[model samples]
Target chain A: MGVVMAVPRHVACVMDGNGRWAALRSLPRTAGHEAAEAAVMDVIEAARSSGVTWLSLYAFSTENWRRPAVEVDVLMRLVRRAIRKHAPVLHARGVRCRFLGMSDPRIPAPLVRDVADLMTLTRDNRRMTLTVAFDHGGRRDIVEAARSLIRSALPADQVTEASFAEHLPYSDTPDVDLVIRTSGEQRISNFMLWQVAYAEWIFPQVLWPDFRATHFRECLDAYRRRRRRFGDVGRTATTTGEGPR
Target chain B: MSRTTPQESADVFGPDSILRRLVGQARWALPVVRATLLEAAHPQIGAALMEHSTFLTHPWRRLRNTATSARRILDPDPRVRDREVVRLNRLHARMSGTDAQGRPYDATDRDARAWVVATLFESTVTMCRLGGEVLDADAMRRLYDEHRTFLALIDGGSDRLPATLPEFWPYYDHVVEHRLENNEAVGVILYRLLADVPAPPALRARPELWVMGRSVAGPLATAIIVASLPESFSRRVALPDLPGARTLMRSTYLAAALATRYLPESLTRVETFMGLAGAGADPWASVRRQAGKAAALVRLLTPAAEDDGETVRSADRFFAEVLDQTGDGYLRWPDLAAMAREVATRLDLGEHDEERLFQAYAAWWRELQTALDGDGDGRVTRHEYAAAAASLPGSGLIKVADVLFDVTDADDDGAIDADEYHNLFRTAFQRDLADGGGTSYSRGAFVRQFVSFMSGQQHSSAYASLLSQA
Candidate 1:
């Protein structure tokens, strides 16, 4: 079937395999995270060129809690160092930086400084938005949304698939259209909850540090091949036919 | 020989200088050099009468060269002009104060650095919050630069924060549209990105299932999550278009930009909201400088609480439904996750409570679907209730009689009862404030006197005020 080049308005990626990527090169795992951070600048610029308004990257997950505390601490410090170093480029380009994750009480104290510091520094950027999903869990997001609604006193029958989305953690962002998980991982690993219900998923073999914008484009190309069906008939199904996949 | 002069050295450096020259050729650099000195105290600021033992002036070209080199490599953006100003103030503070990082001679200098941090955070946050209204990237970058520079004040003085946060106090304000680095815990970013997956719209009526989305959806869900707690009317106004205003758009956008370059401490919400704000600086320490980070509790004049601590729940479920519906729209706004985090801080809500509130929030959504899913011919649709079922909030809210509800003759043909309005009105006056904080009717010192006129009087009066403002 013929496909439409429907690039996602909002694109999200899981920057995975930093440790493995570093180890494979006979380097410290910390090097991998650093490399991945360095790589972010190029990809970000590329994304802007492509006109993607919102880019969400999976930097850390709630499940990552199982790792050794020291490694985590190192990563947190690296994040600060990278931000301190790369922030000028981001600011000049007009890119706004924030993240998706558990609120402060859930995240540790040492890292909170960098988080808070970064948030305050770049509050007025406009070129593009980059959201880092750190220490985030999908199920927790849904539950939180549900809880928010109950406190508001909404009635029983009024609840719908659409009603609940209003309360989720990312309620302020748009629905995701495509998601790319790096480091050869085939799994989605619990990311966006309500926002990416119908998002197309792609798993690339390259680790986050090595993944380039061209690779990102390839993923978008793959997403472009599918016929999205929002539990309804595809547009082609009803019409004379742009055909089907 | 390197254009180093003893006189200039005496002017800028502390008393411990090992070497000094008589004079040199590049002494013309004083204009720029003098500005830096002015920024710091004249070894003394406005009100101060005393002088420090270590105070001294030093060479300008070398420091200027260092600053230029640093900005060239680490800070190439002009948008962060406020950051430059803050850095200048901080250095100024350190020069005047005794306890700067390098100054061993003067450790007793009153902590002026704290004020610099505090002001920097407040000004930057306010600037970003307001600039986000237009969704201008340039403006956002500028504010973010200011945020980052203020962070140098004293990140290690973490102990200076409020010894302890207030118990049971709700948080609602926070920075937004930025990304924070998680260097310490390699994988750990910030608390802003906690959820495993994005929360999706749930099936109507069964709101309890929402709590389990992470576990329930698992690998099938995208592996990124973020949320916002509740924010107030003022935040919404910060953007444009709400009642169509964009001011209330998204915090993630604001947080993300700033996170990449924020007042480092403010983005993360350390021991206190942030350490640098210098909120409790000595009253005597004052500087004529630009406002830094501007953090303030959102002030709203809500309805007054009753004398009996009874809150009158509004019978306008329709308005509540609209609020819920509008909230759903929040999911699609630009940087909502950061906005959610901001709301959490603004509300001072715990993640657990935020989750519960969301559950309650989802449960309350039931009434909206029923209204929206009407027949094409305008026939009303009704959801059945057993009547004997318990009315606990967690279970589900019952759409009962509003004071102005129209009860139809269901006996003749299963219609609503007209007296439901009076029942709803009565119920409004007799609501139970389940949360321990206080009765829904109890107004914390925050409520203004003028708004108190309509408390417990008429629901329409509150609506009238809102409408009048709109």
Candidate 2:
């Protein structure tokens, strides 16, 4: 008999090392991004099938605009193409798509429209929600939330953590339970600061382009093996729920 | 016994001192978690942290704040350092709370602060020794003495911490062996270090370098922390262990020491000299200040229609007379939903169109509540509604208007006709009026509401005329 494991409700991924993967293969960075399409689809299918309710992918960061203009152009086009290609598949699988942090003017209008269309098409999907954080910066999101609150003319004393959280983008999105940053580079790089405050993290050493469903499942297994205490004492035989300190 | 002069105080960690020589190297950060664990092991410190700190929710942030405070204290500029001392004192003054056992804990307590300083001093030596950058007995003693002086600066008085290297060890050992509690704080940190070790944000962009070092960094740091713990301490607490962890630590720290020797200061030091470039100084502070000034100037030059008292009143009246169909003092989701249903009924719309109108109103309510619902009571007061309405011209709520228009304009036309507009007003002013049976509002009222919704133009006369019609 096997012990039942508690699966995380929401899992977020920072898909890193695409450029590094391309460099390793002596191919253009675009090739690595192109290859990541398979990994994204695979992860989505895996998460949907494995009973995960919410999955967020770090598709592009605000700082990614600092890359060479040519590469940025290619990435924007590639992302649009990927969205167009995956919309039907995602909708059919009942995966609701939401684009977070889409405030950047550099994002093409047509791509924005396409994203809106995708969101509307998948609006009623209840199986899973796939939030793609494009042009997102955690710091920027926080600043925007603050700005929005100020514009609302809310009294200072009335602002609580719960109220402040409601001002953030996708306020309905639940806190992330697990954050997997591929390529074994263990930096958060300003992704979802408020959401991932207490999230467990996994760095898998594999570049995102090469990540597969097996790796995803392995990470989920690792998550189950670990215990989450959230500041309280854990349940152990040697120690009562309350200890000396 | 005598007070040290300013010159004498400056001599601690001064030029040619071993403490200064070893302090800021990037590799020193390796034992930071270990030092933190040691500090938390002290019962008072652990109890205080558990009571007052957001350590569980924001562990790295807590660590960063500590680092920032330390950096400011160690800043070469006297003004910066002194300012930080004052800040630290002020901050510690308020950090008093009770632990789970109802024992009061004060962060400013001498023994707890002393224990914190002790861990820092001991961890520095351990970090140096493990990495093969050996410090002699004299250097260790000198460093310990320097740390005592450092403590005096922070404590704002003579050092009450253990005065000498010999005295410090027994004090440290006794606490580690006996007094240290097998608490959850240490367990959580150790678990995090082993399972979710994150690189500092400073190293975020250096993926290749981090990847090369990550395999060793997390496990090695955990191993060092575990190994550094005394057998009694480890036994008392459920300290985690790794197979061959010590071997891994030895090899990696040796390589790291070699790298430190060969690498440039930029690669080896986490922080450089204190100046404008220091981490304590935000590089964008000046830019942000200038931008703020520019924004203020723009506001000054722009039209003041948005801030007009009449505009606020107009919005207030609209909330009371239009959206508050229940004649209640507060507007809630049901009011908005009912308004949408009324508009659908007035138009004699199909079920699908009715649902669309309801969804639009819900979306609008969500946007408004997300922005303006300060107390989050699920009800928007007339004042809150009016305040939000005053700023509606260019805000995201304006986008909500577009959504509402799209849903309500069922004919696929770009605009709503007078009949459609009347339907909206009829739903809005559904509350029983004293005059009764006269639902038709003047064209001035219609134009005024339209301008507020579409163009957001504020006119006192228009509002007065609209109020007369209402």
Candidate 3:
């Protein structure tokens, strides 16, 4: 509606190079994750400052499980930490916390609780939704939605594109208006498939750990520089909507 | 502690994430863990509890006392009777909100759970010891449902389900666990019926209400539920193995009613997030019980709800009978797709000019094809999917919720709760399926759901005329 609404209905970020970021600094990958957590604060605040409402950050990925056992352990630990670590700030900032892949209760019950608690605390906060996609696969979300609809007692022909949103992981997290993939990755890597369809893509070369408010602002500047068009009749080539990468 | 201190706030975070560590440990060591948390905060939990009447209430007091008691059992040598006391106390503590580790309860803390599974022998003996409490229509119903474990059977073999079933969804036969096989391709027609009913019911009639956690179902809906109750709260519902479930429909019915009320307690109960654990689970239990207690109070203090044996039109009953298993091939998924395409094409609405037709049936078909990455027999056909999309009330803007369902079905389990639902949508919509090519409309099951959703709205409106007197 206004710049207030221009705050990306959805924003996805590819938090890349955690290991490399750690390795370059001669620290444990966990340290990098820890550093990344700090960076998360920076990006999130900057996004909120820019009037972006929903920020979907790509933290741990489904493929990340392929990493060394030690690394995976550290990541899971980091995940648990991140969940508890951000509570007060989340409550203060009026941001809700949700993880895309970790739904089952068996998936580190404590971490799950923390994530859930944070979300519960900020459930009423309309400021913005900061979604952390952990071990989430974009393709999986699409298929899952299909399957869920199929199982519902609700009728089939009744299903529609807009209707499906009610069943998604980040159902209320707005449409992706700008995508910023750190470490210069051009691919969305199966981040948000359905919601990001029309989001504008921006690739920043800076490694994730090095990324800061300045870089975040740069992305916003870039986002402001472009125009968004959701495949309609009038707008043709230049402008596109924003979404998180 | 006045206004704000960024550094102290930060103290609770990072790799130095004390809260996280505390939460993780709380599951295993509740008391010390909780005390640690309350200690970290100003003015400990015991003190906090003293300040709030919500804690002094029966349930909270029992919960608090048990937690304190359990901390005693940790010692090596406790008398046999006292040890027995420990077990009984655990049960009492749980109801009070204390964590399993005998720590103070923080309803908001995700990791803490006041688990106290009561043993059968003790509970049975306990029931015999304490006389039951019964009040009026609502109270009796509430207590009956919450307490009655054994139910006597009458005509039907299974008394588990309500005698009178819902009409439109006859496919709900407890069939094949999660898989319901309707010989008739009811999915297609049902979807259509759901999408565009001649006159849909008001929103309140539906179990899962809209955004604000409320169902605007009219008074008629209540009357309908009331009508279904066997008119006798003591009807027997025998279970095959475990003690027959309490015939007490009061608790269950009230849960549904409370859900319809749109209260915060109901919000905690219905909202998908955090629903599985802690206070979030059965958050509405208290609300329903309170309503029951209020009903009891009213019987003592004022006029209770009066039910006239006078003849009332059995509209819901008639609809239920007519709605069930008509099985005629009235509408199909393909028909819906065609309709969606027609509508989208007519509207000429799209986010970008090129994608204007993207919301159409053809676009839906392509999108579905792409999502499948493989072809299937009844997969959402481009036309079928688009029809669903174009059918939803929204014009051009993509419903973020719809996009969520288009993703997130890892194993095809069929249904996703709110949390899982949100995760899937976030992944797909945010990721844009990798290259950011706009998501297609054929993944439009959500649109169909929306169509039927309007029916609840209609039903609620119908009920409004009758209930306004209350």
Give all TM-scores, in the order shown. Answer: 0.36, 0.41, 0.37
Cα lDDT, all candidates: 0.40, 0.66, 0.42
Candidate 2 at residue B315, lDDT?
62
CAPRI tier of model 3:
incorrect
For the candidates in turn, chain A alone yields TM-scores of 0.85, 0.91, 0.85
**Candidate 3 per-residue lDDT over residues A115-143, each given as its tens digit:** 55555555556778788887788888877
- The complex in candidate 1 yields a DockQ of 0.02
**Winning candidate number (DockQ):** 1
Model with the higher TM-score, candidate 1 or 2? 2
For this target, which candidate reaches the highest lDDT against the unseen true structure? Answer: 2
Q: Candidate 1, B462: how far from true, in Å?
A: 26
- What docking grade does candidate 2 earn? incorrect
Give one digit per residue, the lDDT tens place, for model 2 in B1-470: 32222232343456665655555665665666678788787777877665445444333434544555666566666666666676566546646766667778788998788788888887787777877776888888778777776677778654566666777788888878877787756876676545444333333223444566877666666776687665677888867667786776667667767878997876666553221111233433443344433333233233333223644565666665455544346777655654554344335455455556666667777877887777899788877766666555443334445544555455555545445544443223321111111223333333334446432343223222222111
Taking the tens digit of each residue's C-alpha lDDT, what string does model 3 give over B1-470? 11111121222123432222222221212222222222222122332232221211122222323333333222223342244333432322322343223546442221111011111111222222221222344533332222111111110121232222131023222211222122111222122222322211122122232222323322222322222222121122111222222233234334433443454543432222221211223444444344433332232233222334311222232222111112122222232232332222222223232133323434434444444323455343333332342233442223422432333332345544444433322122232222222233233544443333322211221122111100
B1-470 per-residue lDDT for model 1 (tens digits): 11212221122222221111101111212112222222132222211211221111111112323233233212323333233433333333422332222333222233333332333333333333533434255543433333233232223232222222231012112211111111211111112112232222111112234347645443221121111211332233221222312223244335433553455532333212111112122221222011111110000011212223122133223222212111211111111122222222223343454444334333433432343334332211222111211222222222111100112111332222223212212112211111111112212211221122112222242223221111
Fnat, 2 decimals, each candidate: 0.02, 0.00, 0.00
